[model samples]
Target: MRRLLALLVLLVLPLAGAHAQGDPPGVKGLFLLTDYPSQTVRAGEVTTIRVKVNNAGLVPEPLALSLQGVPAGWKADILGGGQPVAAVMAGVNQDVTVQIRVEVPKDAKPGSQNLVLNARGQIGQQASLPLTLTVGTETPAKLSLKSRLPSLRGTPRSAFEYTLTVGNDSGKDLTVALSAQGPANFQSTFTEGFGSNEISSIPIEAGQTKDIKLKVTPPRDVKAGDYPVLVKVAAEGATAEMRVTLQVSGQGKLALSTKDGRLSGEAEIGKASTYTLILNNDGTAPVEEVEMSGTVPANWKVEFNPKTIPSIAPNDKKEVQVAVTPADKAIAGDYVASFRANGRGEQASADFRITVTTSTLWGIVGVGVIAVALLVLLGAVARFGRR
Candidate 1:
């Protein structure tokens, strides 16, 4: 019986420290620690702190977590795996890290502040950890450029807009000039958020930030590829740069259309009619060695003037005359014809309907027959009257 009592004492001794701290029985080795839980950041900046929980207990424990004593206008969250967590499951004798993201407001005062986090486990098991963060009035550098999105995609002639926040950490107001360098024929501009006013330079107050919009436009003739653009902002004593990537997609485009309003026109049998067709390059690259061809009905002929064009630049148009002829013995009806213009990597086609009609001589002969019949009737009436 004495030996049995001694075994019970050994078990109760391990939990004495836990009971003194008001933690649940048999719950020990729960610690909140981190290598970088405290840091100094600029005002209006966002910072993240890592808190590691080392659970040496044999059983898994779900610990409820929360942030306490957060400043006004500041946001704080306990995140696990990039998302907020209501509770963290601590494995036996293992370590897990949780992230705390702290967003400081722009109007926050510059000073040192302390934040506390409370974690509660099963059976009234609780732990409170304190973290320190220092806010500096001045940023690390005199000029800082921040962009939410640095890469964008578009087709040739597509417009790309990016919003960037420029911070002036200097103690005085600064006049900042903005510029960008990109491929030839590309256009870019800077503008303020309000009034859409185009601005080459802007003034930022001391320790303040301003938002700028960068609008980039690739030329219609630009090739399909990745183009890197560097945006630079410079002041009297500071400079900042940001690199933007523009992805241009799709091959060149070609279009074929008739100059006249009618895709269908009237023509006489056994004769040829002329129509004008235009080939347009609406894509990025120049089309070279463009060959023209057509599909027509049996025994019909189609011809194109100039045979083929040497080259057509982007956004430019070239005119070609097409002469279509029908067979002499062919009947008057409607016929469909398709024409094509092809280049190295692009092609365009257009369909047309040709309506055939008889010659005017047939109409004139019918009119003569009617007139002769009227004369004959008049003669018969005169002879009958005399009798």
Candidate 2:
């Protein structure tokens, strides 16, 4: 009877040990947090925290998850109702995704909000890795200014147009003010909503581009040269600027005229006759440093009224004189003289025709002898008739 009982006890002990191996008494698995991003989130943003309950035991068990330490405006949701998982098999892993939402007000100060997620199961209870929630005010929008028309090159009194490109690099919308500064004569105008010489607010969204036109007109009296103009763009907390060059040029008109097409006075050899040529500036611009030169007959001389005339303003005119003389031994039927005037990008010339006549002398002696002979003949005729 004793031998039979020992055999029965040994069999029962082996069976109990087999059941114990199937179901472990203490927690024998790792409940790890997975699927959750690096534990930090911005205010007003939502982040998902995931927990993976890994069971490395011989038996299955249930799992329960819960969240804690969330701020007032923040909230968290767990999968499986924070209840114990029905049965997590030994050496098997279970996954849980918890969503954390942060609702920070606009007035929320910049600081860190601490959050914790606790997952409990039959095997053990595991706390999730600490998550840091950063709350702060949104960043301001960024603004930039660009000029499409690089330079303006035109005569004074003429209007010039410039196009401007405005870019917004912020993550939000922005309204920018526009202005310009340069020479007093330089005038600028923008699109309808964007006025001239005032704060023009333009609404631009993040990563957006807009085009505007700026019409610049220099005063009529402005000199010919390069002038710099500044274009400014400003937003709530951002500002930008661009520079433009305004080039002014001179404007003028030139005309040429002659007193006579032909030169006709009869003169002896070695005598001279003069003719005139005129140049005028009809436009409202000055002509400076006049000069006259051209090929002409050797005996001809060309001269200007004022050898080096100063600047001739609008509606001003200047004259030049030319003189022609024949050589003493030359017989002159007709001669041509040509000349040209150069000043302020203008040129002109004239041709002159000269005639020379023979000198007077001898013939009076022959006429006196012929008259005496006629008188003698008449006297003889009268005497014969009386006899």
Candidate 3:
């Protein structure tokens, strides 16, 4: 009977020790905040605040947290803990997120406002996690236009290229429209987003930059001068403008000089003789308003199609055709003629040599006549001898 009683006392002693070590009365979990940005808020903007609560006691505990000291027009939301954060184990932490929205008036003064967030539970309470909110007006955006190559100067018919740099110095993204104006004959081709007369939109991110290529081609007839071109850039909130100058110059060109200035064709003295003269513009600029003049022998007549050409660019060549006809009374021989083309800078000339020969049909007729004469003479001699 004594052995049984001693065993009962051993078991009872262990149960009492376990009951004392389980959990203290009214002990709760520790509430910790995580995943929250620094304690600052933008006036009239919505911000999210997040935190985690941990049960640091030996047993599971339920937690309830509340927010305090928010602005009049602001509201706070407890997204994670509507049902009272329940069953958190000892030494383990639970996560909670709180979203706070602050609405500042349009005419709100520019200054700093104070705010506080509180966390509470059945056994413990933590108050006033300090946060600061600022209220101010935002500044407008500013945009600017700059050019990589500001001036274009070249000879007529030469290609002029430029690169423009568009910058957005504002705190927000901006869309800029671009346009350019220049002379009528001066052709300009901009990149896809740019246009000659129409404004095209180009999106530039905040504090970003972009490059646009502009190409210009002057007309061959454009004279040397300082022509002003306007480039305009406009945005929804801002506008910018720039100017470009185009200078044209005349350059002495190399030309082809014709040495052989004559042409010949076999004709029955009245047939036509065709002559070709080549005019080359070797100058750096194009040549326009070309006038051609040619002189032929008195016995021959001259006719040319398109006696004058409108224009010819540099390093370009044009041919002028001249038709000459000899008079019926003229003899078959060589003929000489000269031609000149008057252009913008200088004159080009060609000398032509022409040879006139008898027709093949006339030669055949002469041979036939000689053969008939020989036959006739032979026949007369034979008849005389026989007589």
Candidate 4:
């Protein structure tokens, strides 16, 4: 029984020491702390210090906050949820944060002052924290913008995205307005670095940085060359600028057809027929080193005059002579042949219906053979009639 009583005394002793709060380690019940207990402020400007009311192993209580030892002509307010509030309720093992917004006068001298934060709880609980605030000469507001990649290369049809970081080095929160200038007929907009919603301006806290994405699009008819882009971010009469480049590459489109736009022709059996094969470059760039080819029926023969072309200019056409011959035993029927032209990473093909006809010399021989057979049949009938 005596040993049991000793154990209970040990647990109660630790609880007794928890109420004695004076910056000691593991001091429980209630206390307030700011991440930065000391900070420097500029005259004629405003600054914000965040303070949290922490309740560790204590019952829920209401904490009333006030600042002590503030200099004269200085305006200070503790804000909760963007408004001035007198007190906040802190739950067990919870932290309640507030912002202390301090505004200094323009004529304030450069010096240091000690400010005390006092919190009074409803359950006879009281805690105090000390803060050091120094007023210094006013520094000019400044902004900076930097890009991860200042230049990019792609085709005119590609999506040019640039990643940029905007920094605010002032003493107060700022709303930064974004703008950009690019080549004529180009569209540019600002969005979240990893998002798609476009925005014109964003809010940034002092000494903080935000990443933004800039998307640019050029006209489909844009030529191949280097394009310059200028980006600007301004706030509170301070501006930051950055210049970037877009290297666009041109491309070409190919078209294959006959000049008359006819895809049908006539060829004789076992004889080669020559037809004009037209190739056109309908794009902004030239087509180079184009090789001619064709797909014909089985056992048939095909060839091209000047089998390869050197180049075809933009909006220009080149004609080649294609000699397509039908098979030796090819019957009188229609056949399909595909002609193609490949060059500069582009290709074009056209299908032509070729009608095959027997030679006139063979036709004449067939007529003579039929006539001889008819005459032989008539003579045999006359000989049998005389018998």
Candidate 5:
């Protein structure tokens, strides 16, 4: 009984260890599986399917991939990591995914075709997966583009921003290029809706949509009118276009100068000298709320009679009087004085040349003192001669 019990123990131990390690006893297998084993495809279009290679308690090995029973006029290839691959490796109890891309010819008949995807290991393990494809009518690649705000109104200095949605209806992923058509000197750029960095193209997945932003900036000298812009998108064998409008409004162009276009003026120390300034509106829009300001030498005074003008019509000019005074200790020489005017977000500045001279009161006092001294000297000489 002891011998029998010992033998039974030995037999059970080996079997238990084998079962715990992996598959029990003689169970070893490799499998190829896909959720979509049977599907329909369109002629002249390419499609890919995912396949999984599972190693169930089989020794880790590399298997070569091949397709069997493929009909003529059909193209099939296995892909791994976006590259064509002929073999794949799966460790014991591990699973790996591979892609099988199929391209059907346009001239093929509309009927059912059967194909087999196979993976064979060097140690004599083989796995086969059967697939069915029903070739039907043509399915064309397509794209769509739409803008949320089709038209915008702003000045030439403003950037017109537009939000757009791009959709991919094709059966595959694609990289699409973006472009725009508009008048000369009009700048345009594309970016993601949530991002500020610019992009010329973007990748989109099948049956999905992406939001993008378009910013258009026109030249400062652009005329006020309605301008149209054409936005285009192109992808692999498909294209789309959209039209948008930019309503550019007129803006005020303010300029500052003297009547004779001279930038020089004269001012006396401790006294204000008046200057005539010409403020011209050269744009199509009216200038409003024009404010005058000046920069002069240290401790000097300056002021405008009319601190601010109400408005100036297009192609019109306004005359303003500005008084500038030099500092008391300023030497007699040339000095530069700058004056600026601002109106409706427009600014202009001009420089004036000023020369200083001493006042007449100081000279008169000096002459009087000299005459008094001369009279005293003459009286002294007469007295000395009499003594």
Candidate 6:
């Protein structure tokens, strides 16, 4: 009886060690096992591995799953039943499919990565699934096109400049054709350097970058807003493109002048003189809220008929009546007055020389005095001749 009991205990020890917690429900003999396919992936790519869990138990079994030894910047997800799950159920004597989704980072290096898939049951049944991932060193078709200044601001009918770079990683020399697509009437040109001659294409060596300048000119009548320009660089069969934004600034030009284009005018002391001032908008946009102001000499008053102009259309002109009055005691001489018209951050100014003459009353008094002296002199001459 002692020999038989010792042999029985020895047989039970092996069974207990095989399952520390015990076997799962309805699983009398077999332990948890996991099987999956291996993978070979490239950096900046994603691939999925299929894993099948086999359960030979008499009833369904839930197994906890986990992954280990995943590299930095790499992602792994275990999914069951078409959804991401940490645990899966396997029917009796059936295989449950689990998906292992992996994503390799763009900067990942080429190497062999070891991954372990661990599955644990509540009854202490556990299995580790080993997976090997081979990362390829082959560089993908590479071409990067970017701009130093992707967006710019300028007025219509002006030129905007941008510096662009093209990178080649094709392990050979690449001749890239350059082109730009923009709105109607928008002109674009590519140059090897700033202010250099234009070119239609450029070449870059392996692992090298080339810099080029792009000059974009909008139409003369483009509205004040944003526009898009697409720049493309193409090699043998590869293409790279970038979109550059051009912010159009509004133009408000207030050109001030007189109808006769003369900056000088005549005036009389203690009297008013009127002149027609012309305001022209030479820009592609309208000028608004235009106000006229003048710098006058002492005791002189300058006034505008409208005081403030409502608006001036592009390439259009408006007239304002300017009235100048000298002080009551102003002397008769030449004086200068500076006038400026301002509109929405735009201004134009001109200086005028105002020649002031004496009042009409003074002129009439001098003429009467001259006439009296002449008459008296004439009568004196007649009397002397008679004598």
Candidate of highest TM-score: 5
The CA root-mean-square deviation of candidate 5, after full C-alpha superposition on the true structure, stands at: 8.2
- Residue lDDT tens for model 5, 245-300: 99999888888999999888766678889999999988768889999999988998
Off by over 4 Å in 3: 1-135, 192-199, 251-387
TM-score of each: 0.44, 0.38, 0.43, 0.58, 0.63, 0.48
Local distance difference test, each candidate? 0.83, 0.62, 0.65, 0.88, 0.88, 0.83
Candidates ranked by TM-score: 5, 4, 6, 1, 3, 2
Q: For candidate 2, lDDT tens digit of each residue in 90-193?
A: 24333434344445554556787776655455655444556666665567767877765679788876777777888998756677787888788678767732
When 3 and 4 are scored with TM-score, the better candidate is 4
Q: Show pairs that collide, candidate 1.
A: none
Output the lDDT of residue 98, model 4: 92
After superposition, candidate 5 runs with Cα above 4 Å error: 1-38, 42-110, 114-132, 136-140, 172-175, 192-208, 235-238, 359-387
Full ranking by lDDT: 4, 5, 1, 6, 3, 2
- lDDT value, residue 301 of candidate 4: 93
| TM-score of candidate 1 versus the correct structure, residues matched by position | 0.44
Model 3 alpha-carbon miss at residue 271, Å: 14
> Backbone clashes in each candidate structure, one number apiece?
0, 3, 12, 0, 0, 0
The alpha-carbon lDDT assigned to residue 280 of candidate 2 equals: 74
Residue-wise C-alpha lDDT for candidate 1, range 1-387, written one tens digit per residue: 999999999988755643554445565667787786677766777787888876655466788988888988899988999998878877665667899989988888888888998878886667778888888776333888889998898877579998989888876578889988988888999998554888999999877999999999988777778999899988885899989988887556789997765688877777899889989998866888999999988898899996899999878999999999987777989999999999987899989999988889977998999999999999999999899
For candidate 4, write residues 1-387 as lDDT tens digits: 999999999987765565443234564678787889888998888888998888876777778888899899998898999999888888656678899999988888999988898999877888889989998775667899999898999876788999999999987789999999998899999998778899999889888999999999988778888999999999989999999899988767789999899999999999999999888888778889999999999999999987999998878998899999998999999999999999978899999999999999999999999999999999999999899
Q: Looking at candidate 3, what is the lDDT of residue 58?
A: 28
In model 5, the Cα lDDT at residue 269 comes to 75
lDDT tens digits by residue: candidate 3, 1-387: 999999999988854554455434464445554554344444555555555454433233444445555556665555544433323223332233444444555455667777655555455434346656666566567778788668878877678777788888865578878778888877766664354442256789878987776677777767678787787777776877788888878764535443263333344477886656667776666777888777777877877766888888767887777777777677778777776777766677656666777778878999999999999999999999897
The deviation in Å at residue 187 for candidate 5 is: 1.8
Note each model's CA RMSD in angstroms.
Answer: 10.9, 19.3, 15.5, 7.8, 8.2, 15.2
In model 1, which regions exceed 4 Å deviation?
1-32, 37-216, 219-239, 243-266, 275-285, 288-321, 326-340, 344-357
